[model samples]
Target: MLIPYTVKPRPDTGLINSKLGIWLFLASEVMLFGALFSSYILLRVNSVDWPVGSTILSVPIAAFNTVVLISSSITVIMAWASLKMGNLSKGRMYILITFLLGLTFMCVKAYEYNTKFHHGLFPSESTFMAIYFTLTGLHGLHVLGGMIVFAYFWGPGAKMWKTEPEHFTNRIEIVGLYWHFVDLVWIFLFPVLYLL
Candidate 1:
C-alpha cells in the first residue's frame, strides 16, 4: 500500500509528510544553534578580552566560503525547479553543481582550519577560539551532511525520477530546504565569527 500525503499536503497541516518532517527537524536545529549562540554571547560579555574576529580569523577566506554557500543555495533551488519543470538532465546538472560548490566550501574551511592549527591556534587555546570553532565547526558539519544527501539523490537515487517523479521531486525539495537552512546558518556565522 502507498503512503498518504507524501506529495500532497495534508489538509490540517498544509504540508506533506516530508516537508512537515523537515520543518520540525529544522526547528530543533534552530533551538540547538540558538542555545549555542546565546552561550557565545554570554561568554564574550563575561570575558575580559575577547580577541577581535578579524585579527584572529581570515575574513577573506570566510567571505569566499559565504559566496560559495550562497551559490549552492541558488543551484539547489534551480535543481529542484528543473525537476519540477520536467527536465531531468538539467536537474542533474544543477544538483552536481550544488554538490561541487559544497565540496569547494568544505575545502576552503579545511584550509582555514589548517592555517589556524599551523599558527598554534586551537579551540582550547582561548575562550574566543573555542566559541569560534564550536559554531563554525558545527556549521561545517551540517554542510557536509547536506552534500552527502545531495550526492545520494544525484547518483543512485536518480532512478526515482523514472519510477516516482513526484516523490523524487519532493525529496529534492526537502533536501533543498535543509541545504538552504545550512547556508543561512553560515550567513549568520560568517559575520559573527569572522567579521565581527
Candidate 2:
C-alpha cells in the first residue's frame, strides 16, 4: 500500500518574504530612476529650445500608452491578489493579461520611435533627441525584459501555483514589482518627453 504526504515548507522560507523583499528592491530602483529624471530635467530647463515634439511625435498616442501601462499595473496587482487567495488559475490569467498589456505598450512605443526617426529627428541632430532616445530606449528594454520573465514563470511554474502557493506568490510578487517599476518610470518619462 502507498500513502501520500503533504510537505511543509522549511522554516527558513521566511528569510525574506518575497513580497516585502521585492518591494524594497523596487524602492531602490525608483530612487535610481528618480536621479536620472532629475538629470533630464536639469538638462531640459537649461536648454534654449522649448519646443520638443513640435512636429515629431503624437501627444495623444503617448497619453494612450500611459493609460495602458497604468492599467497593466492594476492587472498585475489583481493577479498577485488572486494568487494570494489561492486561486492559481485566476492568477495565471491575470498574469497573461498583464503581459499582453505590456506588449501593447511596447508596440506603441516602437511606433512612436519609428515616427520620430522617420521625420529626421535622429539623435545625432540634437541633444533633445539624444537624451530622449537614451532614456526611453532603456525604459523600453526593461519593459520587454520583464515580459520575457513573466512568460517564463507563466508556463513552467504555473502548476506549482496551486499545490505550492507560497513559491507561486513569491514569483508573481517579484515580477509584479519589476512590472510596476517599469510603469513608474514611464509615468515620469511621459511628462518629461511628452507633456512638459
Q: What is the C-alpha RMSD of each candidate to the true structure, in Å?
A: 1.1, 5.2
Q: What TM value does model 2 have?
A: 0.84
Q: Which stretches of candidate 2 lie over 4 Å from their true place?
A: 1-17
What overall lDDT goes with each candidate model? Answer: 0.93, 0.80
Q: Write the per-residue lDDT of candidate 2 for residues 159-182, one digit (tens) a residue.
A: 776577776686787788788889
Error of 2 at 53 (Å): 3.6
The lowest-lDDT stretch of 10 consecutive residues in candidate 2 is 1-10
Clashes of each: 0, 0
| Candidate 1: worst-modelled 10 consecutive residues by lDDT | 187-196
Q: How big is the positional error of residue 72 in model 1, measured in Å on the Cα after superposition?
A: 0.3
Q: What is the Cα-based TM-score of model 1?
A: 0.97
